[model samples]
Target chain A: MLEFLERIGWFVGLVLVQVLVLSHVHIYGYATPFLYIFFVLSLNSGIDRNILLIWAFAIGLTVDIFCNTPGMHTAAITLVAFLRQPILKGVVIKEVEEEFEPCISTMGFFPYLKYTLLCTLIFCSVVEMIDTFSFFDLKELGLKIITDTLITLVCIFCVEAVFRRDKSEERF
Target chain B: MRNLLDFLIKYKHWLLFIFLEVISFVLLFRFNGYQGSVFFTSANVVTGKVYQMTNNLTGYFHLKTINSDLVQHNAELSIQLEHLKEAYKKLTADTTVIEQMKQEALMDCRLIKANVINNSTIHANNFITIDKGEADGVQKEMGVVSGSGIVGIVYQTSAHYAVIIPVLNSKSSISCKIRRSDYFGFLKWEGGSPEFAYIKDMPRHSIFEVGDTIVTSGHSAIFPSGVLVGTVDDVGDSNDGLSYSIRVKLFTDFARLNEVRVIERSNIEEQLELEESVVNKER
Candidate 1:
């Protein structure tokens, strides 16, 4: 019960930060890093795919409401959520087929970084592409995608470090 | 039937994904406008409250600059007031001229002050949210201007908050012209620096130079005539090479936008009705 509540709190916290704070930070006038994908990344692997999709939709809608982008965030984040399982399967090793969260502690450092980077790339590309909704300027879109993905990856790396539990600090 | 049920169960997640994406696409294409349903937009109550809270937290940092700006504007207003008083006294001596001026004053508008609660300048289609809303007489199509220059048009308004599609958005286009020669162009932002926007479709023969001033042409009912927009920084040929596409340095620093005045034209409805009648007659 406590774990469930903690997870819910973390989700809300991320959405709040993304909407109220990070959305306002447009680094160098183009790269607005969206770090809320960390919520989708940190969810337990055992959770149902259907449930995951709903959660993704909910977070995306929350962000879209604040940013006034209508359905763009929803479409992009839902794509990330939908692609999460397949991407995870492709990245993870066969031996560690357990139902742990995709944090640095659960997945080894290299595998976790790879997983986060791939997901961030997919999510950022979807978002930037849908934002234009047309082939207006491919170069600008490419710049936005690459820069935003890199920024989001840096944020996710910071989050991974912050959330990593020390052995002495672990309750178990 | 059993096989169908089994298939349905197997593909439920995929179905859900498709369902959500469909809803998103519908919202994207259908309700993307500022006048679209404001229920899901930032102008809505819950989101508005969140943005307002964040604004309150960050607003304190901008107090020094905002105060100085207010003082400067106050001084300018006092000077204008003195000039207007002298003009009024002179005009009153000529009753016929005073009557004509009064008749023109009937078309005068009012300004409602609002603070910028949230703004984004980096997106291709950026939006700005202000603290004023429908209750504050802020309606869609109303012009928003800072003390410096025109800010944007009020796109959506809720009971207590409103969102503006500023000059920074790629989707934004405001009708403006050269102040010296009345050669008009449509001002558009092509997404680089927020400080500059491009004016398209200026006549190739029109003579212009850098530092030339551009102001609203009043062709659109949204903004008044001769309102300052920007100054020409660079002039170049349009993509088709037929017309001039001039770059303008906007006066409103959208990043430092703290307050704005929403302009409400008193006879807008009547003017729109008249225009509509003309179109109807032509059709």
Candidate 2:
């Protein structure tokens, strides 16, 4: 129950930050870091797939509602959620079969980095493609995808580092 | 039946994923029809309130710049007012022209003041949310303009908030013309930069320079004739090499947009009805 409440808190807090602060930050003219996807990316790997999908849908829809893009975020985040299990399995080598959240502490730095990078890239590409909804200008589309992915990667890593330090202190 | 139920349970996650994606696409493609439903938009009460509070905080930071802009505008307006006063004195002897001026004034539109609560420019279809809405007499198709120049037309409105489809959107096509040459075209945004847009379908023979001013043609009832839009920045040919596509540097900076005026044309309904009646008669 406590874990559920913690998850809910992170959900709301991330959405608020994304809507109020990060959504307005358009670096240059192309990149806007979608930090809210971090919630979906950080969900425990052992959770029920259906529940995970629902959680992803909820966060994505909340963001879409605020940003005025009806389904762009929802679709992208749901896809990320669906692929999260496979991505974790592919990136992280499990020493023991146990339920754990995917983060730097449990998965180690390099694997977690790979996991975050892959998920962020997928999420950014999907969202940007849906936002554009056209292949007319592949150059602009690729630029947006690459820039958005890189920026979001950097932000996700920064956030992960902060959270990792907090968790380590709590453990100590 | 047992096998089908077992299969459903087996691949339920895949089915759910497909179902949710399908719902998202439906909501996205059908968004045009759903504009009237404000629940999913920034104009909704909850989002509007949040954005309003955020704007209140951020708005303070923009005051210095806004004040300077207002001061410069005031100086220009006073100079133009002086010129207009001199012209009025010279034209006082012509009663017929004065009557015509009165008639033109009668056709002029009124403006409702509003502040920008939420705005986005990075999206392909950019939208801006303002504090005023239906209760403030803001309606769909009403032209929105900042102090500098044209902003956009109101796309949807709730009781206390409205969303504007700014010129940066790919779907936004406003009638604009070259100021000096009077050559007109449909202004379009190909969705890269917010600072510039393309005016397509201008005739090849239309004479316009790089720095020529572009203004609303007022072919549509939304914006009045001669409202400032932008200045021509570059010129090129259309895809078929038949018409000219001139690039325009939009005057209203969407990034720093804070306050705006929604132009309420007094005779818009009457004009629309008249035009519809003519179309119906022909049909």
What is the TM-score (0 to 1) of chain A in model 2?
0.95
Error of 2 at B31 (Å): 1.1
DockQ for the candidates, in order: 0.73, 0.78
Model 2: residue B241 alpha-carbon error in angstroms? 1.3
What is the C-alpha lDDT profile of model 1 across A57-119, one tens digit per residue?
A: 999988898888889999999999999998888888776656887887677888898999998
- Candidates' lDDT values, in order? 0.87, 0.89
TM-score (chain B) for model 1?
0.88
TM match of model 1 to true structure: 0.92
Q: Please give the range of 10 consecutive residues that has the lowest summed lDDT in model 2 chain B.
A: B29-38
Candidate 1's residue-wise lDDT over B166-250, tens digit each? 9988778899999999999899888778899999799999988899999999888888888899999998889999999899999
Q: Model 2: how far is B67 from its true place, Å?
A: 0.7
Q: What are the clashing pairs of model 2? A: none
lDDT assessment of candidate 1 = 0.87
lDDT of 2 by residue, B108-202 (tens): 68889999999998888889999999999999999999999999999989999999999988789999989998989998898878899998899
Best by DockQ: 2
